[model samples]
Every structure is written in structure tokens, then in C-alpha cells.
Target: MGQLSRPIPLLLLFGVLVLAGCGALGPGFFADRSPRERVLLLDTPFYAQEDYQCGPAALAMLLAWNDEALSLPALSDQVYSPSLEGSLQPAMVAAARRHGYLVYPLDQPAALFAELAAGHPVLVLQNLGFSRLPRWHYAVVIGHDLARNRIFLHSGRQQAMEISARLFERTWARGGHWGVVVLPPDRLPATAGETPFLAAAAGLEQAGQWSAALLAYQAALERWPGSFGARVGLGNARYALADYELAQRAFRQALLLQPANGAVLNNLALALAAAGQRQEALVVIRQALELDGIWRQELLRTRQKIIADQP
Candidate 1:
């Protein structure tokens, strides 16, 4: 509990919780035993937590690594909840997005090591207490030493806190294995799949970050050229930026991947219409109309809009 500074009463409770929480390790640590003697120690920056500000402090570490100039206090104001005395996960994600970073969720414990190996610091949530009696804390995973069976973290009040990998898994599992790797939109997470990577980029789109979303989608396409979602998202991001011709190009490429896909068809038609290819837009929407799916209403709307558009 070196980094986990709490009230005296809570400190005493945490000591008992720690004793009670110790038990057998899960299969997760043993699942991927390869790369047996590897080690990666990132030069990640550290900012010690002030009370319940581990969330912001952890985020600051990641942003600093990315060379973003935001200070710790400013970050605290953005993510901290006065009533909750700490920050929520969603807020942490949103704050990262606001700073133009792609916040990718690391769903598995194995992903933490994978990302660290790839030189990305991972922000993780830990349950420092028992599940029923929870004391939530956030920290950054900067490196791993497999030979010594240790994982390094920038935790509360500790710049280089090391914990056993087995114990780390238990605490992380109790915290729902929640972690994220925050990086610029142009960089991809080491273990991110096509689906989740596209999903994270879509979040930037949803946030109205068209330029950032464009970069993210482009990065996704670079890694996964066959990803229909990346192609569609690239188109959507372009459309938002009023680059109708470029958007149409992306939609057309996406169509090649999955011809007769209603969503892609609708998007392509919309882009065509916006680019003033009204006749071609009408034809595309008509083809989409023949596909039997829930997008029928949406297709008809695009058709109607194209028909009513002035030549």
C-alpha cells in the first residue's frame, strides 16, 4: 500500500483485505509462457498520485509519454469527480480523446505485456482490496521482467513500483481486467484486433473529431487493409470534413470488400450524392434497396434526398 495512501481506518481495512485476498494464481499468467526471458523497460514518465487522483496521474503519465503538454492539475479537473472522490473509466477515456489520442481498451491481462513489449505504457485499474470490499486504484504498467516474474508500474506515490505478475493478475481480474493503452491516433495498439481498433476510431468519429478519426482509420487500414469498418469509417470521417470526393473513394473501396452490403451501399450513395454525382447516387441507392435488410428505410431516405437534389 506504499502508493495507496488512505485514511488510517481504511489503511487497516486494506491490510486485512490484502491478507484475505492472497490465494492461488489463475491460468492467465501461464497461458502464454513463450518469450520466456524477455524484458522491456520503457522510459515512461511518472507523476505520483495525490490522494484519490491516481486516475488523472496515470493518464498524465501516458500523455507525457506521447509528448502532450497538459499539466496534472488541468487533467485532474477534466476527469475527477468531486462527489465520487475519484475519476470514472468513461471520463478517463473521454479525456484521452479530447487530447487527440486513440484510447484502446486492453481487455485481457496478456494484452498488458504485449503492449509494454511494443513500447506503449498501459493504464490499468486495480482492486487493492477484496471484491466485496473494494478499494479501486489506477496505475500505469510501464514494463515487464519475465525472468524475474515481475511487472513494473507507476503507482500512487511510487515512481517504480514492482509487483509479482501472478498477484497483478488476481488484482486486475478482480478489477474486471480493465486497462487501456492511450496513444496518438496514428499509432496502433500492439494487440488490437481489427474490430476493436475500428471501434476505438469510431469513438473519435462519435466525438466529432473528424481529422483525428481520419488518421485513426487510415492507421487501421494500414494494419488491416481488408477491414470494411476501417474503409467505411475512413469514408465517414472524410464526409464529415466535406471531402466528398475522397469520402466516395473510400466508400467505393469498402464496397469491393463486401459488395451488396447495405450500410456500405448507403454510405457510398450518400457520398456520391454529396459529391454531386446525383444520377450515380440514385443508381447506388437503387441497388441498395434490392438488398433485404433493416437498412431499407435508410436507403429510401438517401434515394429521396438524391431525387430531390437540384441538378
Candidate 2:
């Protein structure tokens, strides 16, 4: 990790300068909230950072609050860069995934507040200095006092740092307002939309966490019952877990929502074939092939499998 006493690099300074010239990060969604609005604070554990270890420390706090309780040093191994003297963003996402948590970026500034309201701590990047000399830092936002126009964070050596919302936004904007939350398989982010949340759960399915991915997809479907992507994910997870009947049901439901979706039709065919309905599977696979685009090869493969397996 980089030394705390080191001066900000020229490149970072230039980035900060550019952000400064762009003006405020737009009138964020929460700007109109009354000063007397409700305050929210999550009971998250605090871990003071040891120099450039804020990334690990902030991640540990978030994990602990989520009941993971991983050690900071252990996380450092996953996210820290010995060469760059800090953690990279992809490594941070990977580390969260390794721990069986689905991580999604909070794109809107207001989403951070929404997550806090839902009792989830958010790890955010900040530039804590002037445009001429930026000090990059990672901190966990655990609470907000709209009445005071302040945000509470576990930052640096301080356990509970109260910063003005304006300053916080300025620094956060420099980092592209980057924030992320690690969610358990069964829980969906309070502020997360259908597309991003489905994407996150799909990542779990891709990693072969069939059961976890199933739960994530179930949550997504609960939030968005008509989401074709969620249904496809549910079907894929069920298929991976060998629940062919449910897999067929999920794929069929997705087809009902998007009748011409070739991928869904292909998955339905595979589920039918797996469940010993070879003739029916061939019919479905043919339909998939009829509507196929990028999934044409996959539909053809499913059709071949059904034909090969016919008694």
C-alpha cells in the first residue's frame, strides 16, 4: 500500500482538476430533501485503517456487517496490490465474489442513501484533497443525517467521521461516485434496479454456484416477476442443480414473457430432453432454431442431443 505521507501523484491531480471544472455532480436526487428529514445509522463495526489499507478495512467492515466477519489481512491478500500499493477495483469485486456475496455497483448518488436506509453499509472511493493535490481514499458510509447535511463514514484513523455532504460529494465525484455493496444470495439491494441486479445474480450462476445463484435469481424474480432475464437465470440454476421440472417451468415462464426469445426456448428444450420428453424437446428446439440469432448454434446442439437420446 502507498504511504499516507506521500504526495498526490500528478495524474490523480489532473483527474481531480477535470472533475472540479465539470461543476457539482449534478443536483443529486436527495438534494431536495428537507433538512428535518429522518436520520439513519446502521450499527456497523468499525476498523481503523493502517495506512493505505482503507480498501481492505472498508471491505472488512461491510463483510462483518453482512455477517461474513472476514479478517482485514486475509482480505488484503485478495484485493491488495503489492506493486501498485493499493487495491484494484476488479480485485475487490472478485474478492467479494470469492466470499459468496454478489457485488453490484451503485451508479446513482442517491442509491447510496437508499442502501443506508436499508441498513447496508456502502464502500465508496473519495478524493480528500483539492483539485491540485488529491488524496485518494476508500471509506465505508454507514449513516446519514439529512437534517445536518452530513454523512457518517468509517474513514482513515477515525472510526466515525462526519463529513459535510457537499465535501463528500465533491470527493466522491472525483472517483466517479464509485460505490459497491456485497449482498447475500437471498437478499437484493434496496436501491438496485432489475437489470443490474439480474446481472449480478447471473454472475453467480456463471461461477457455478448453483444453489446460491438460484436463491439470487429467486430474489430477483420476487422483485420483478416479469423479468425474462431473471426467469432464464432461474431456469439455468435449476437445470444445473438437476431440477429439470422446475427448470422447464422457469424457462417456459420466461418464454411466456418473451415468446420469441431463442435462448429461453433452447433452455426449455434442454430441460424437456433431460426430463425424458425427447419428442417434445425436438419440437421446442426446432422453434428455438427458427427464431435463433446468436443462440442458433446452441439450439442446434440441443436438437442434436434430443435426437441422439431418442429411444
Candidate 3:
């Protein structure tokens, strides 16, 4: 999708210190229990990484689960860096977005389980070796069995590689606990928060995928109707698509949430102007200018444009 070009020597698939045996499968493995223990194993497809193409393999697996079929070779070409012998995280994210899929990060270990419980596979970065001598790798977490204290993964050349939850946490933490789930724009991650979800949607918008961003923003609004960020994002996406009226409606919703948010008012005024409501746009911009926010300068410029359009 031309989202990235520079090579990033991040995640690679190579020799990792394979622990002799799966550690103790007992509650003592790691002490964290939620309301109830459940076992969830997703039917995620596996694509073994050839050489250092773990990034493409993991991304392809995620896309396949999302029903967007893409060949490993094509994915490698898009995300793999031959010079670096690995794929950059940016390239992996961009590749997913290019296929109309949203990549949402699983910020914590809990978020990974949450996604798995919600029937979503998470692509994760791990340091298979010690922090001092790191062997960075990418893998897809397909399932988690709390009762068994094991996490299932489609990683490297293994179809159903099982690792103790304790080891998984150690490795994941060493890799900065980086994990992401790829899904359709309409779907929301089970553990999604308002700010992060809106930021992810904004990624699509910033990438110039306004339609996808609109769907993402709509999904965010469905989950959090009162989120000013979601509302503003929805308006921005609509505006980008040239749907001025709908954009104005979204901005209005945001204004209701925080009336004095000059940023929202600026957006509303801009949408009003785009819809040919010059007088209303001027009025809104004036209100925005009277208040104080980071958009004050933009509000002043907006007023100038609106007044300059008068007869």
C-alpha cells in the first residue's frame, strides 16, 4: 500500500532456544485468575516462515483468518526486508491495512487472551532468547488454555506449538509485549478502549482509507456513543469522502458531548462551509474563536474564509 519503504530490523524467524520441555502445567506457573477459567482454541490457518519471513507468515495467517487470502510470497514482497533479513512492524501493519483489514494492538498479555476468547488470532512479537542476546520472532497466538496453563501458537515451523503461559509472558515482555489482531473494519476487538480504538481508526484515515476509516469509526461509536474522538473521527472520514451533510451530523454529535471543545467546533464549522452553509459556518467559527483550544488559530482562518466568501 506504499505505507512504508524503509527496512526495519525488528522481527525475524530464526534459531530460538527451544526449552527442553513445557514447564509445569499448574496454577503456580503464573498467578493470575479472572472470574472463570475457559479454554478457547481458534481454527487459525498456519503458514510457516521460510528463513526470516516470520513477519509475512504471521501477517498472512492473520489475513487468512479474516478471510482476506493473500499469498506468502506477495506478503513477503510487501513487508519483508531482504537486507535486514526480517520485516518491520510498520510494514506488517501497513500490509494488513492495504488489504482492508484493521490491525489493533493487544497492548498487554491480558489483551491477547481477550482477543483469543473473542475468537480472534493475535500476531505477536517475541524475544525467544534472553534480553541481552535477543532472538526476535513473530508468531500468531491461536488459543489459550487456562486450565492447562498453556498458550497455543502457530509459530515458526510449528503448527500447534504449545508453550507454558509463564514462558510466553517472559518472552512477550522481553519483546515489549507487542501484539496485534487483524480483522475487518466492522469488527471491534473484545478489549478495545475508546481512545485506542479511535486512534486505530484514525490510522486508517491517516492512511487515506476513508471508507474503511468510516466503518471503523462507526464501530467505535456503536461501542462508545459518547466518545468525542470517535465522533470527530467519523466526521473527518465523512468529510474526506465529500459527504458533507453526514460529516456535519457527526461533528454535531461531538459538539453535544463537549460543547466548548474548540477542535470539534472548528470541524463543525468546516463541514458547514463545505455544505455551502456560509452564514452558519461563520457563526460556528466565531463561537469556536471565542472559546480557547488548540484549534483557535485554525478557527480564525476559518472565519476569514467564510467572511471572504460573502457577496
As for candidate 1, its clashing pairs are 3-156
**Candidate 2 local lDDT, residue 157:** 84
Please write out the lDDT profile of model 1 over residues 1-311, one tens digit for every residue.
01111001111211221101103354347456453355545579889889899999999999999999987898999999989988989889889888888988875656776787788888888898998998889998877666677778899999878888898888888878888989899988888787777777776765667799999999998998887778888888888787888988988898787887777788777777776777887888788888747578777776776676645
Best-performing candidate as measured by TM-score: 1
Over 178-218, each residue of candidate 2 has an lDDT whose tens digit, in order, gives: 88888898898877787777777766654567788889889
Over 4 Å off in model 2, which ranges? Answer: 1-30, 33-42, 129-134, 304-311
Task: Please give each candidate's TM-score.
Answer: 0.85, 0.82, 0.84
- How many steric overlaps are in each model, in order? 1, 0, 0
Q: What C-alpha lDDT does candidate 3 achieve relative to the native structure?
A: 0.74
Q: Residue-wise lDDT of candidate 3 within 183-252, one digit each (tens)? A: 8888998888776666667667656787998899899878987777777878888887778899889889
Q: Which candidate would rank higher by lDDT, 2 or 3?
A: 3
Candidate 3 vs. true structure, TM-score: 0.84
TM-score: which is higher, 2 or 3? Answer: 3
Instruction: Tell me the alpha-carbon RMSD of every candidate.
Output: 11.6, 10.4, 8.3
The TM-score ranking, best first, is 1, 3, 2
